[model samples]
Target: MAMSNAGNDYPLSEVPPEARKGLASLAMVLLGFTFFTATMFAGGKLGVAFGFADLLLVIALGNLLLGLYAAALGHIACRSGLNSVLMGRFAFGERGSKLCDLILGFTQIGWYAWGTATAAVVLGKYFGLEQGAVLALMAVFGLGFCATAYIGYRGLEILSWIAVPAMALLLILSMSVTTAKAGGLAGLLAIQPSSSLDLSTAITLVFGTFVSGATQATNWTRFARSTRVAVLASLIGFFIGNGLMVLIGAYGAIVYQQPDVVEVLMLQGFATAALAMLLLNIWSTQDNTIYNFAVAGCNLVRTDRRKTVTLAGALIGTALAVLGMYDLLVPYLVLLGTVIPPIGGVIVADFWLRHRGRYPLLAEARLPHYNWPGLAAYGLGTIAAFGSPWVAPLVGIGVAALAYGVFNGLTRGRTTAPASL
Candidate 1:
């Protein structure tokens, strides 16, 4: 099949050396992508459940693990110039890759629908709009959010450059207000937990909240100019950016008993800033989310019409938002945390163990219809993760990697000469 690289984003092909991006462009976009409101909501739960110091520790440890996982994948992405879906062709085979496309694509669309609903509902309540107006707003924002994604990576980068700084300033302002209200560090430390939650659950919530996004972040990291840039950007985004969201949410919950950042801003008498924060925060992630859907859509259909797919996804997400995707956030997040990490694990194992840290060019390589080892490993990993009481995302990744390694080893041994064996 002939591949088109018209937009230069190369959805179905390798991102060539000349098209690689610098640290600032990649990092800013990733930061914007990670600055999600749902993550803040998850953090709010942790804030009320644990003591201040314990909450901090949970946030640090969870984000640390997420950062390391993303950096490892980003390193491979930068070297190979392929995102997770494209890499899926090698890990899961040409036809088998559709499993990842379907899974990852569905998750991204789910997020897009959630974000769209969130923006409309929050704005409607803030402005005292009726239900009809709120639904209309959902339709409007749903289409508007995908504008950047339709233009591809350059559009995402430009918006991120604008949104990341503004969002950062807003977060700092909200945190400062919360700090003053709590009477500074001493008072905040003295605040008792309002509820009880186990350490394991807290860590799981923190890590699981954004694991899916981290898994697909290779969509951007593949454009990194070097492996160093990719790894650093991934850490900065997943660790620092995601950590700030968790910290701010917990801080607000502890002080004002409100976990929503917009509400916190309103309580601090920054109503205008609250509206701005809501728009910027959701828009940044919404675009990235839909972009992910489009990329997965392209791979699923074997097309290069990413812009068209993006528009179609926007329509679907908008419809879902209108049909009440907002109410499904918690369960949806739980599902994401459970199912998404194993895909990354399989890709990592395929690249390092089977392909020896290098993948053949997708355009030229002849791929099989299915790779049983990867499929079987993913199944084992998913089952282990679902049944495990520990951090599900981490368990999924580890099990998937180990299973793939064992399967590959056995296959290699079976294929070896009898005399050599």
Candidate 2:
């Protein structure tokens, strides 16, 4: 079948040139990826537990590592014009790739639920609303996002342009007000933390902030016109956008002893701003979560049901959030932080080592049902992540990359394409 963006969301084919985007649009979309409420939540934890100086060091270092991980997969996405799930068909094999689809898809659904429920909870607190009212708000947020995702990438881009700047402004406002009232930057630095978060655990939380979403960056980066654009988009998103979120949480925590962003704004006499920020901030992540779910579901089902799958995911997530699934769902997001990056590890190794910057057209490529070596490495990586107490994501990536490289090296790096092609 002839392929185009159409209703397909490019699940099974390269994104056509006409649909390819530039650095700015890709950056905008990637920036939205970091504007998630979870980053703020993680930041709040860091702020309360660690001194400002220590928190800065960990957040910067952690995000840089995440940036590199996202950039590597992003480079592959742009070069191949394939999202993570389709790329998995090559690295993990055709049928085997569905595992990636399921993992990626399931995680995104969990994220959507968390974002929706969190927003509902925050809004409920602000409005003194409760129970059924909060559930209705979840449905409202979920369905609203479902419409955005139903329109696909363009919708995400448009929404980000509005939400990112608004959220950032509110974060700055809360930080400024809190800092002034509590003393200042020097005072914040001078004040000792209430306690200490272990360096390893703090770093883990840092990684866990966006590690799951980082794996699926190709969903946005595949629109990049070049590999450099893809990498730049990711670095800007993870390093700057994510770091700012941490700063907001850290500042508010240190100064006001409040880590919840909405609470911080409300306490600062910005009730209107707090509500606006909460709605938009959580909406930014919420839309992308459902969008990512739709893309993965399309790949999983072997159809171009992006919009249908998107709406279905929103409904599922909204239902879960109303049922109080987010309290339980958050841990899965944290678990995925460590487990999901191994997929990127295998992908980076496969793209850089095996294909050497290029791959045959996905549709015409003769691929196996499962690339056993890749699957084996992924399993080892997951186990290693669980087995290790420190630097779990990094350890998983290293183990997976080495195991993948070794297996392929032993096999002479076979591919479906003819050698001379």
Please name the candidate that would achieve the greatest lDDT relative to the true structure: 1
- How do the predictions measure up, each by TM-score? 0.96, 0.95
lDDT of 1 by residue, 163-235 (tens): 9999898888778878888898888889999899897888888888899999999999999999999999999
Stretches of candidate 1 exceeding 4 Å from the true structure:
1-8, 413-421
How many pairs in model 2 have backbone atoms within 3 A of each other, for residues 3 or more apart or on separate chains, i.e. clashes? 0
lDDT per residue, candidate 2, 338-386, as tens digits? Answer: 7888898898888778777678888788898889889998999989988
Q: Cα deviation in Å at residue 232, candidate 2?
A: 0.9
Q: Give the TM-score of candidate 2.
A: 0.95
After superposition, candidate 2 runs with Cα above 4 Å error = 1-4, 418-421
lDDT of each: 0.89, 0.83
